[model samples]
Each structure stands twice: as structure tokens, then as C-alpha cells.
Target: MLLQKFKIKSMSLLTFNLLLAIWLAAVLNVPFYERMQSLTPHTGIKSSLFIAASVGVLVAAYTFLFQILNWKWTAKPIAIALVFIGGFASYAVSSLGVLITPDQIQNLMQTDISEAKDTWSWHLVVWTLGMTVLPIIAILMVKFKPEPILRQIVKKGIASVVSIAIVCSLLFVFYVDFAAIFRGNRDLKGMISPQNMIASFISYYKKKAPKENLPLVTYGTDAHRVINTSKPTQPKLMVLVVGETARAESFSLNGYTKNTNPELSKQNVISFAQVSSCGTATAVSVPCMFSGMPRKDYDERLASHREGLLDIAQRAGYKVTWIDNNSGCKGTCDRVHKFEIPAPLKQKWCDAEGECKDEVLVDSLKSYLASIPAEDKTPQLIVLHQMGSHGPAYYKRSTEQFQPFKPMCSTNAIQGCSRDELLNSYDNSIVYTDHVLNQVIQTIKDVPNYQTGFWYLSDHGESTGESGMYLHGAPYAIAPIQQTHVPMIMWFSPAWQQHNATEVSCLQQQKQALRSQDNLFPTLLSMLEIKTQVIDDKNDMLKQCATNPDGKA
Candidate 1:
């Protein structure tokens, strides 16, 4: 009976589309309007005119899209899908300040189930139902008048043409205002609700979805280990610790105010002061860093089918193993040995959600090394991927003992908390990460006769309420420095450093030089002493520091 009162008995399909467009322009675009208002200060008459023009353009744009797709069977389905997407997009923008770009969509698609659960909250549930469900109900209740197919087609075509003309005319008249808003702020396009989400989703799938079968292209086929006879006779073992969401600005080792590196400071490690990430998200940065492809030329599709550092290292006779505590290896460990936290290890370190603190990585690595046969000591390259400072659940990342900073934010709705609370929680996670890295260094030190070295590099950085942004995965070109500048640290056992003739003093001297994840691929190959045509000497940061004993290198 309630539904019957609101039902439309006779409405043309074009009229239905117009009403939908008005709802989308007026209701679903609150975030867009707020953003524009913030950008353009109130200048009385001019400000009012700009706001009016912007709404007109937005309504016309949506009207054009709806009119073109005005089939009897398809129009409602498309409208319903867009309404739901718009609602979620608005919430994400207003609450978290995340833009819906292709990279962000890719990150969402690749996120694991446990990680996805961390983003859930009661606020989100209420907001989603209120924004999307009510509108969907209203859409379903509408009843369009029956029309002949030929007449429907002609009428819809005319409506679309009229919408296009209106949109073009409004945009032309407000050229100066539109240009000022969009020219400097390219990411503003992502602020528009359903349009941005729709375009980004389609763009991501078109680029990333699999095509016809293609053979994998392997690199460094002629790769072979060049053993440093001067080194220990046992074997060479290097541990690469891939950190998650750690920004250089937050690390004391990189001049941060907090003492986030208490344990690391005691050790003799060189912290690279100026290091940039390949991308603002792990899905792109992790694969790109390993692919030996520089950031500028990296194509995720191509990187997936090509050999990476691990593949080439294994080919060169090193026992390459990837131990993960965050998401899966993102296909970086497909050709090499991979390890996950066993049930026993999880019992000791993991939470109810199966999200483990990074200490599990250290514990798991220790157990794995212990199980290896005493005599079978082929050189080892083990990667420890840490779940460090992954937000908006930063408080969950560190254990009670590791959280030094007080009055921390404990909920998933990080934006709702005070800024100090958020920073404190995030900093405590870094402190815990410090402990994990120290443990890794200690574990490698205890290994008997093997020549061991350690390298720590964060996949990317995070944004902490900067410029109305939270989290990471902003498009690389427009990404803030917080999301691109990452922390990197390197350490080596005394025996290993002496054996490889690596000058620690030289490395420390060059710590402030500009470097990036691109240096990782070739530098790692150089550290493993693998001989391959693929290793570029210019990209290796260690190349300048090597003493080149016996003039072999």
C-alpha cells in the first residue's frame, strides 16, 4: 500500500531518465559540490554563477548517458547499477578521500578477504543503505508507459542530442571557471561520483583482463652464481625485507621526530634518505620493482608474463623463497618457492581475522631455516614481506607491548578519530615494524657459516590526513610526496661485507643520493653476484662502492 502511493502510472522513458539524472546530480553529487565550494572561495555573484553552471553541466552529462542507453529492457538495469556505485563512491570520497582511479580499482580487485574486512564499519552500513537502498526502491517502483519500438528509438535519439547541446553550451559559457578547477587538479575528475567509478572500472578491466594465451618471457637465461671464494665456505644468504606502507618521513632513521627505529639505530645499517617508490600501491609497485622495468616504462600486463628478480635469482642457483604475512606475493613468487604462515605459527602470532603481526614473518623464517638440511646449503635469497602499517586498521598492526605511543585510535573508522590518535597508532605500528626488522637482523646473525646480508625497502608510503587524503594508491603523476617517498635500509654481516669487498663507509656517504625501487633489481643481482646480460651496472647503487677484489667484477 505504501509503494502504491509513490508509483508512477504513466511516464515516458525520457522523463524517467531525466528524473534519474536530476537525482544523481542533486543528491549523489554532494561530495563533488563540497569539493568545488572548497576550491572556489565565495565571491558573491561569481561563486553563485559557477555553482549553478557546474550543476547544469553535471545534469546534462548524466542525461546524455541515460538517453543513449534508453532501451526498454536495459535502461532500468543501468540506472540501478549506477545509483549503487554513486552512493558508495560518494561515501568513499567524503569519508576516506580516496579517488576512484584505475590504479585504485586494481588495488581493490587484488585486496585479500581479510584486508577487505578491515574496512567494514557500522557507519558504512547505515550510510550505504540510506543512500543506495532507498533510491533503488524508488527506481524499482517506477512504471514507464508502453510505447512502439520505432517511436521510442526516435524520441530517445532526440533527447540525447538535446542533452549534448545543453552540456556543450553550459561548459562553453563557464570556460574560465571549469578550466581553473580542472587544469591544476586533474584528480578532481575522480571526484565526480558514478562517472569516475564507471570509467575507472572499465579502464582497469580493459587493460588487466587476460587475453589469448601467451608464452612467458624469461630473462637472464645465462645467469650463473659467481661465488666469492674469499667469503665463508658455507654459502651466501641474503634476506630482502619488503615493508608495507612505510613512509620515510615517519622513520627516525630518515630524520623523523619520533624514535621509531630504536633497535635499528643500535645496529650498523645505512638508511637511504631519498628513496621514491615505483607506484603508490603495492599491486603496481611490487611487480614493477621486481620486473627490472623502470617506473616510467612499466606495464603491469607485460610485467606479469615476464621474469622478475626472484625468477632470475632461482635460475642462477640461489634457493629463492618468498614468505608473506600481508597479501599473497601478487604472482611475484609463481616460479619460485613460496611460504605462508602455518597453523602453528598463526596460533602464536595471528589475530581472529587471520591477520598476523609481522613478528610471524620472523618466526616463520626462523623455523624454515632450522628445517633445512645441514649439508644442503645452496645460496639462499629469502624475501620477508611484512604487513607493516597497513591501514585504516593501524592499531591492529602492533601488539600491546609494541605500541609505545598512547591514546591511539583503535577503530577501523580512522578518519573519525583525532589526528593525534591516528598518528600515534600509525607510529606505533612503525615501532612494531622496527622490532620485526631487528628480529630479522638477529635471526640472520645467528645462522652459522653462511654469509648473510639484509635489505629493507617499503613497497609504498601512506597519506595521513594530508590535503584531505587518507591511505594510498593515488595516481602516480598526481600523488603527494607522502604516497611516493618510501623508506629503505640495508645491513650486512661483517664477514659478508668483507668477503664481497662492499665498502660500508662508501654506502653511508651516498645515502642521501636520489634512488628508487628501480635500483633494487640490478643492485640485488649484483649482491647475489649473478652474472647475466640483464644486470645493468648503471642502475646498481652498490656498483660504485664495490672494491672489486682481484679485479673480477
Candidate 2:
């Protein structure tokens, strides 16, 4: 009875398409317009004119596309999908202050179930449902007046032509302003509703599909460990901790006001104050860091198909292992011994949601070290991938004791929380990470008959409501300092330092030198004394500071 009483009147399909397009452009694009209002220099009449032109262009563009699919069978489904996609995309852009670029789309596709749960909250549900409800209802109720197929094609063609003309005219009229805005702010194109999401997905899939058929390319095939008679005969062991979303600005060692690195500060670690990441997210950074490719020349397809640092280390007779407590190693540890936390161990450390703390990696490391054969004394290269400071569920990342910063932003709807609340939550997570790193350092220190060392480098930094940005994954060109500047810390046991003749004082003096993820591959090779033509000595961060055991540089 309610449906019958409130049924929308029938209208011609052409009229319906035009109205629907207008509704989508005007209503679903509130975030786009809001962003424009902030960015536009003009005010009053000029600003109003620009926005009107933008809306006209958008409506015509939508009309042109909708007309192509305005057939009886496909019209409703396409319209409903547009509404749904627009609703969610708008919410993400407005609430999280994220631009859904191709890299971000890849991050979404690659993310695991446990990582995905961190993004869930009632706020997303309510906002998306609210945006989609009325549009979906109107779509289901409204009737379309259908005509013959031949007539429909001609009408749709004419509409498409008119749309093209209108778009051209608007561009011609506001060419100067449009060009300036587009060139100056490349992110504006990515901020538009649904269009950005559509374009990014299409680009991501197109690039990903062809790479599946490419053959693997190996590097450093002739890699070998160089023996030094002056150095100690004991085998070497290095723990490489790949941290997630840990920003340099949050660490007390990096000059932050908060004591976020209490444990690390007490340890005999050298914290590099200036280290930039290769990319703004883990999906890109992890592979690039190990692939030995600088960010300026990084190609994901190339990196994916190539042999990396781990493969070379293993070839040099090291026991390469990847112990992951976060997401998988992003394919960097494919050929190595990859140990994911099993279900049995979850009973000891994990919550009901199957989220385990970084301590699990420490425990796993202890077990693995104990299992090493007593007679076989090969050097070890173990990578511990920690889920460090990944947000906006920052409150969940740290235990109660580590969370010295109070009144944290507990909800995933982080935008709703005050900036202080968000900072407290993020900082607390860093504190926990500091503790975890120190624990790993301690574990390595006790390993007998081996020269042990530990190295920690975060994949990327994050934004906590700074300049209206919440999380990481902004486009690399326009990414903020908070999203690119990551923390890098290292510690070597006294035996390891003496055995390799490492100049700790020289390393401390060079702490403020600028470095990046590009240094990772060469530095790791140098530390393991893995001799290969692929290892660029200039890129080796430690090579310049270290002297030979005979006091020769």
C-alpha cells in the first residue's frame, strides 16, 4: 500500500537520464565542491561562475555516459551501482581525507582480512547508508517510458554529441583557470567522486594483468660471502624488522617532545634522524626497498619479477627467514623460509579477533633460534615484519601499560575525534613498537656463538588529522612529510661490532645524514659481507663509516 501511494510518475527515458545525472553531479559531489571551494582563489561571483561551469560539465559528461547504457535492461542496475560507488567514495574522501589513486587501490586489493577489519566502524555504515538510501529508493520506484530500439540509439547519439560540445565550450571559456588548477593541484582530479575510484581501479587492473605472464628475472646470481681472516670466526646473525606506518616525527630519539621511544632510547641503538621512504604505503615500499631500486626509477612489475636482497643473501650461504606478524612480505620473501604465526600460537598472544601483538614475533624468533642445528653454523638473515603503528585503530595497537598517552581515539572513525586524542593513540602505538624493537635487540644479544645485530626501518609514515589528512597513501608527488619521513634505527651486539670492526662512533656522527630506502639493499649486502657486482658501494650507507679490522678504511 505504501509503495502504491508513493510511486513516482512515469517519465521519458531521456528526461530520466538527464535528471539522474544532475542529481549525481549536484548531490553526490558535495566533497568535490567543498574541496574546490577551499582551493579556489576567487570569491563571490567568480567562484560561483566557476562552480556552475564545473557542475554543467559534470552533468553533461554523466549524461553522455548514461545515455550509452540507457537500455531497458541495464539502466536501473548501472544507475544503482553509480549511486552506491559514489556514496562510499565520497565518504572516504571527505572523512578520511584520502585520494583513491591507483596505488591506494592496489593497497586495498592486496590488504588481508585482519587488516581490513581495522577500517570497520558504525560511522562508515551510517554515512554510506544515509547517502545511498533516498537515491536507491527513488531509483526503484521511478518508471521509465520506453521507446523502440532504433529511436533510442539515435536519441542517445545526439545527447552524447551535445555533451561533448558543452564540455568543450566550458573548457574553452575557462581554459586559463582550469589549466592552472589542474597543473597546480594534480590531486583535484583524484578528489572527484566515483570518477577517481573508477579510473584508479581500471588503471590498477590493466597494469596488474599483463605482469602475471612475465618471466622471472634474477640479479646477483654470482653472489658469495667474502671471508676476512682478521675478523672473528663466529657466524653472523641479523634481525631486519620491517615496521609498518611508523613516522619519524613521533619518535623521541628523532627530537619529538613525547617519550615514545623510552626503551629504544635506553638501548645502544643508533637512530638515523633523516631517512625518507621509497613510497607512502607498504605495498609499494616493501618491494622497492628490497628490490634495490630507487623510488624515482621504481617499477612494481620490474621489482615483482626480479631477484632481491633476500635471494642474494640466501645464495651467499645465509639462512634467510621471514617471520611475519603483519601482512605477508609483499612477495619479497617468496623463495625464503616464510613463517606466518600459526593458529596454535594465537591462543597465547592473540585477541578474540585474531589480532596478535608484535611480541609474537619475538617469541617466534626465540623458538627458531633455539631450533638452529648446533653443528651447522651458517650466517642468518631473519626479517621480522611488524604491524607497527598502523592506523586509525591505533588504540588497539598498544597494550594498556604501554598506552601512557591517555584519552585515545578508540573508534576507527578517527576524524570525529579531537587531534589530541588521535595523537595520543598514535604515539602510544609507537611506544609499544619501541618496546618490541628493544625486545628483539635483547633476544639477539643472548644468541651464543653468533655475531648478532638488529635493524628497524618503517615502510612509511602516517597523517593524524594534519592538514585534514588522516591516514597514509597519498600520491607520492603530493604526499606530505608525515607520510614520507620514516624512522630507521640499528643496533649491533659488542661481539658483532668488534668482529666486523664497525666504527660505532663514526656511525653516530653520521646520524643526521640524509638517507632513504634505496640504501637498504646495499647496506644489507655490506653488513652480511655478501660480495656481488650488484652491490653499489656508493649506496651502501655503512661502507663509508666502517674500517677494516686492520684499521684501514
Candidate 3:
């Protein structure tokens, strides 16, 4: 009866749906649309017709797949919600130049008010209005058809099939041109506004649903530091600095043309030239790096449940704490003492209500380490997670002193800038990271009581206009080199090596070998002189460089 009383025109309903698809593809997907449009200049009637024909195919396919929204009871509300969410999330990725992966969704859900405030802008508000709000209001006001369900299905299906056929025919006619365009711009598909987010979320949900809330698996429960003759008299303090988005391609220490590592290069640091990250995003990389499993065998579902480096360290009689200046340690530090960037840090170092410079991770950090109530004989493991080179506001990361490159792309809307400008902004952030690491080393030197060593490696790397891709989070199987090749540098004080019986020269030579985040677990264990049941000899880079408590080489 309700359907009969409020009947709508079939043409009106179908037209609205088609128009919605067109708007989403052509307007909401700005990054993708721009790339497609730029492929062939709007030269004459032929180019104009090509653009129209290509768009028609896309909208037709969308209409065909979206006919599910014609279902009687549930489809309308769900479709509406999807459109709304698509608009909002699309705005986020568009403004931030980050990928819309499941990890990103999780991060968005977990973001605190303080972390969100810095992301707001008038530009974002206008973009949202244009993308979804007006469209939503228009969609709601438009009359929906009361056509018979069977007829609706038949009609929409035929329309969809015909649209797809037309697209196929067109592709066959212009196969060569279309193939080259897709080949050159493979990443354009990831920029498809809300459709990309929706697809990613659905795929993520399906994979995650089965293993939701599995029991945590503990490792090294029987862990205890052995009584080694080589154990230093002074308690050890080892800092593991997990950097965000610091690619080796931008670092001078790794042979980049730019002097992005001036401070780090000056220090007695050994830079591992060839280091790969476990994953391209923090959510995957952080847990994977800490897991005992190597990247090839890593299971994302198992990562959350399994014990990581922190748990093993804590079990091995080390007082460990995870201090985060970026995303919360991605559940890698859930079992440990986790500290956010101190809320009281001044604006010079951090913005309590917004994005904080990576410097805050080390500012007065030595004093805090001194305060850790470690048992007299226990060593300390401090994990400093930095917000290094996180984009698209790369210019904000570095202070005035470190801006070696001029004319940076300062805005969060990074795609609008030239590639050189983007690289300049990204390289500036690298310099700032160098400065922060130098300061951290200085603090370690100031602490006279403990024999300290620092190991710094990025969580993952960034993609700066490489192959027309803007940020990280390409699937790991085929992620670009820029997104996987990260910078790993280490500093071992002379006192630290001598006191801990570490052979610094031997460790430096081992730096030439290929390594990954998988090495962190057993390598650090070797540095701490803690051997556990789970330690893999092949992954332990430090075993040959340092002796056990009995001092056997």
C-alpha cells in the first residue's frame, strides 16, 4: 500500500542513480579523474567524445553493479549510509594523500579528539559539501520508483548488461590506447573516491570476521636473561626508535643526492644501506616487525594474538616501555607500558592538540629513562615511535632550522603540487628526523649511569610521486621499492660496547648484509644478551658480534 500510494517514475529513479554514479566517478574521485582527463588533451571533437564515451562506460558498469540497491527492505538505507561514509572518508584520503586500507579505518575509529583537531580545515569542509552533503540532500528529495520488484530487476539487469556490452565494444575498438593508459597509470584505480574505500572495507571485513577476538598467544614465558660473564656492570639502556615514512631514497647516508642526513652522518652511526620494511603501513609493519615470524610467513590475523618483542624483553628481565609520537603502537605494545607523547610538551616540540614534531619523542627523554623504576640489576628497553615524514603536511614536520630545500609544498592537499615541490617537503622532514636522532643520541650520552645504544629504523617508507603514486600502503606483494626500502641506522656509544662486551667493529661489518624488520627481534635479543627458546639463529644479527654471559664467542 505504501508503495502504491507513493509511486515514482522508473526513468526518474534510473536517471538519478546514473547521475549519482557519474558525479562520484568524475567529481568525487578528483585525483583519478584528473589523471584520466590529462591522458589525452581536450584537442577536438574526437578527444571530447572519447572522454564522454569513457565516462559512460564507467557509469554504466556502476549502475549494473549497484542494482542491488533496488532491493525492497534493506538496500536503500544501506546504500544511503555507504554513500555518506564514502564521501566523508574520501575527503580524508584526498586531503591527506594516504591510502584507505583497513588499518586506516581502524586508525580513524581509534583517533582521539586531540589527534583529529589538527586535521580540520575550511578546505575540507567545502570539499565535503561538494562531495556528499548536497548530493545526499538531492538524493533524499528525489522520488524513488514503486516499480514491481521482478520488473525492476529485469530492467536494471538488462540496462547493466547493455552498458557493459557497449563498454566492451568501445574497448575493443580502442584497445591499444586504453591498454597503454592503464599500464602507465596502474595506481589510478586506488584513487576512485569512496568506491575504493568501500571495496577495501568489505574485503577487510570478510578476512577479519572469522578470526575476530581469538585468544592471545604468549611467547618466551619461560624467558629469563642468562647470567653471562660478559654482562656489563652498569645496567644497559637500549633505545629502539621506530620511524614513520622515512624512506632510504631520501637519506644522504643511503646515497641520495640531497643531504638529508647531515646530523646523522656526522655521528658515529652505521647506516644499513639496504633495509626493507615488513609492510607498507604502520598497522601491518609494526606488529610484523615485532613478531618472531619473517615477512614471507607473517599472518596478519595471528599478529595481534601473538607476543612480540616487548613481551619477550619484559619476560627476559628488562624494564621496557613504548613511547608513541605517532599511531598507538598498532597493538604491538598493548601488553607493555605504553606512553603517548607527553601531554605537557610545549608547542616548540609538540602540539598537545595537534600534530607534534618528532622532536618531542626525545626532548627530556633521558631524564624519563632515569626515572624508570627498574630493579637494580635489570636493563631498560625504550621504544620511541616517531612521526617521521608522515604526510601530506610534510612541511610541518621540520622546523625552520632544518628546511634545507626551498619552496616546499606546505598544504595537506599534496597532489596539487609539483613532484619536485613534494620531494622537497618530504626531504625537509628527513632532515628534521636527522636532527631528532642526533638529539636523542646526545641525551643517551648525557646519561652516565647506563651503557646505552640506539637502533633507529623506519616502520615503513613513503611514495613521493613515484609511478604517479602518492603515499604508502600499496599491497606488499607488489609494493614499489620506495615504499619498502626504509632507512635503518644505529649508534653504539664507545662506553656501551666496552661495558656490554659488544664488538662494535664486527657489528659494523655485518651492516653490509641484507636485513628486514624480522631481524629486529633476535638482533635486539642478542644486544640485550637475552636468549630465549624462540630465538632464531639466522635472524640474530648480533649473535656473532656479542658473546653470551659465559663469554663464549
Candidate 4:
């Protein structure tokens, strides 16, 4: 009789488990399985089957526990919370390519309260509440009750405990195996643990910290200070456009099908199609791009040793200005003239809903430029960091006026949107970026007594429906081409070219040479005509341009 009772209870638990599995599969979207399929060329079917089976087992176990505990009331709320928490948690954790923490959350909150407010409204409160309440109402209307067999099965605790233990063990094994696969790659390591993610973020300013504390290496032996600038005949202006979430595969300059970079292509911009990023995510790529250390050796120790590009430019006697529309994490331009806009905008640029366009940063740039004296002899380096293509709300990234492609835009998360829609939204952002770049270029061109040169590079790229991965921040080892390949372009006006013709020609020649953020420092120094004692001449792109006037094909 006891054995018969156990069998009946097990059957009821299995039914509950199956239902739970379906819910989880629908909610989480099983990103891991999708990722695995992308990695395995011919084994997609088999890999998907395994993933589905694994998810089924997990859901069954969880449901079995719910049945045994008789805490069905808690399931609705817990599942609802998990859905909402999971989305933002996934985005935040994936953005950093690591684990989520309270401190990071606090930092995000402090950086932009409006961003936090939107997250609360769109993702947390609305999404969570809706998911939780809707399902609960449906269940209540159906008058769902536990089967008598299920109740009887729960009364006998031994079977339930055994089932729970087995499920927990399986989950532990899976996690351990997954972690082991990513252990060797530092990028993967960051994706696993948010705390150990990018080692470049120095929460507190430390004067006595190691050489890597700064993002870039200095030209002088003194390390902390900039080297004396070499005298040049013409005044120089260098504008660096730091783009957000821009991938290389989408740029027409890089041979993409869509004419996304039509403006840049017309302007004789030098596009480096073969360029690869140092890191997969913005948090890792931004600091890594500025830091002297390669991605392989990038760590807290190296972070302390290097100074950022802005600091280097400042030390070289150039007035440095940083205008940003993105999160100012890692304090990259802390010592420079930094203008961060406050959240909850009162202007039309920021709507009543608190959504603001990235073009507003251009206004801030104009104000900053107007404040600078035209007669100032010191060279100037201005950084314009755009909030380009930051997504999930890809439609919000750009207005309809800039929409180059039709049938684009991801309106809802659960509504099955095609890859084309994602691409449309993303491409529209690129179109908007092109407009902004042209505006900045024109502004710099208008400056008197100064020859302007512009270079644009994205902090990192994004994944749009590639291998079922919709966004970026994958572990570097496993990251797809969409995340690592980034758009890099440079524009040199005629006046600037005439003054530094040799340097400009050299840059053009070696434009296709394999390069990463490791070369940005030396390259920038070469452009500014700053001769430092510690500069790595070999890795300097400009120096390479000077030495190898005709690039090796």
C-alpha cells in the first residue's frame, strides 16, 4: 500500500514539474542553450535537445518542491519577481559580463537617477507586477486546487526530500561544469563574477597606487605628469568620438549590406574593417581601450600603472574636455573638464516620460567649445561619448526621422520580433550617429587658428539575434563576431592634413594594419606631436605610419 501511494504521489509531482518547466522555458528563454548552439556548428539540434531536457529537469524539480512544501501561494509572487528581476539582472550582469552586486547597483543608481527611475517603471514594477498578477488572476478564476494524490504524497516527506536533493545536485554539477569551461579566459572570468570583472575600476582615488592605476602610460619618465609638448607650426584640435554599443558588422564602410555609414563614406573617412575590440562589453572594453595593457594582462595591478588618454592629453599641454551621454564608470576622465548632465530633464530634449535623445550631448559640447578662448595656443582634445544604440529599447535610441530601414523596432520583449527588426532599430541608431558625427566634424572645422582631426571608435559592439543572443557582454572567449568586431573611422580635414601630411599619410597607409586599444595611446601621442621618453614607438599607429609610409598589403 505504501509503495502504491508513493507511485501515485510521484505521478502528481511529475505533472506539476512539467507545468513549471514550461513556464520557466517561456520566461528565461534559455539563453545558454542558444549560446551553445551558436558555438557548435553542426550540433545545434543535439545541443538544443540537451538544453531543453536539462531545463525540463530543473523545472520539474522546482515544481516538485512547491508541491511537497504546500507553499503554492508563494510560487506566484516568487515566479513574478524572478521574471522581472531576471530581465534587468540579466542586462546588468551581462553589461558588466559578470555577476550582479549591490554596490554596482548603487553605482548605477547614483550615476543616473532617471535611468534608475526608468528601470523601476519599465522593467521592475510594471513587468514584474504584470507577470505576477496576470497569471495569479487566471489561476484564481480557474479555481485551481491541488490534487488529493498530491496532498497525500506531500504528507509522506521522504520521497519529496529525495527528489529535492537530486535536483539540487544536478544544478550544482551543471554550474560547476559551466564555470570550469570559462576559467582560462579572463574575459570569461569577468562574465562569471561581477566583483572580479574589469580590474580597471578604481572606486577611490589612490595617489600611491601602481603604474596601471591610470588607463594609459605617460610619455615622461616621471610617470605621473605629461611630457613637454614638441613645438608644431599649426594649432591642433583632436576630437575623439567614443561610441556606445556599435558593432563592425553593421557599418557599410566595413562592407555591410546596408548603407549605414553613407555620410562617413562620402567624407573620405578611413574605415578599418578588420579591427577587433579588446573586450566584449563597454565596461571592459572602455577601460581596456584606454589602458596600455593588452586584454590578456589587464588587471588591477596594470590598471594602477596606466593613466587614461584624457590625462595623457592634458599632461601634453592640451586642454582636455569630456562630454558624455553614457555612464561615467571607471572615472576615465575624472581629472579633465567633465560635464555630466543631471537626470529628470526639464527640456523638450528630455520628454515628460524622461526619455532624452543622445543629440543633446552635442548642445553641451557646443557650450563647452564656446567657453574656450579662440586665441589659446595649447592643443585641445575633446571627447564626445555618445549614448549610441544602447538597447532592449532600441526604438528609443533614435527617432523615426533617422529610421533608414523599414519594419524595424522591437516594441515588446515577449512579442516575437525578427532579426530584421532588431537590425532596423540598430541601423537607425547608426544613422543618427552619422548625423551627430558630421555635426561635430563641422563644428571642429569651423574653429579658427586650429586644424581639426576626428577619430571615432566604439567602446564595444552588440549582438542582435545572433545565436539567439540579442545583446552583448558575453564572455570574450565565447563572444561572437558581432560583439568583438567594431567600427573604427578617422577624418582629417585639409588644413590638418597639410600641417601633418606625413603623419596623416602614414595613418592612412597603416589604417588596415591589425590594431586594438593597445595602440590608441601611442597613436594619439603621435598625432599631438608629443614625444615622450616612455612611449612605445613600435605599437604607435602614427609612428608605424611614419616608418612604413606604404602599409604592407
Q: lDDT of candidate 4 vs native?
A: 0.62
Whole-model lDDT values for every prediction: 0.87, 0.87, 0.75, 0.62
**TM-score on alpha carbons, each prediction:** 0.93, 0.94, 0.82, 0.70
The RMSD (Cα, Å) of candidate 1 is 3.2
Model 2 lowest lDDT segment of ten: 544-553
Off by over 4 Å in 4: 1-232, 300-306, 340-348, 353-355, 410-415, 546-553
Q: Give model 4 RMSD, 1 decimal.
A: 8.4
**Candidate 4 C-alpha lDDT tens digits along 34-82:** 4434443345566565455556545546556555443445544544444
lDDT computed for candidate 1: 0.87
Please give the distance, in angstroms, between residue 150's alpha carbon in candidate 3 and its true position after superposition: 7.8
Candidate 2 clashes: the total is 0
lDDT of 3 by residue, 366-419 (tens): 547667665565688999998888765788889989998988988866767887
User: For residues 149-255, what per-residue lDDT tens digits would candidate 2 score against the true structure?
Assistant: 88888888898999999999998998887888888898987878788889998999888423666677989998999987784478889999999999999999999
Q: Quote model 3's TM-score.
A: 0.82
Q: Report model 2's TM-score to 2 decimal places.
A: 0.94
Which pairs clash inside model 3? Answer: 228-549, 229-549
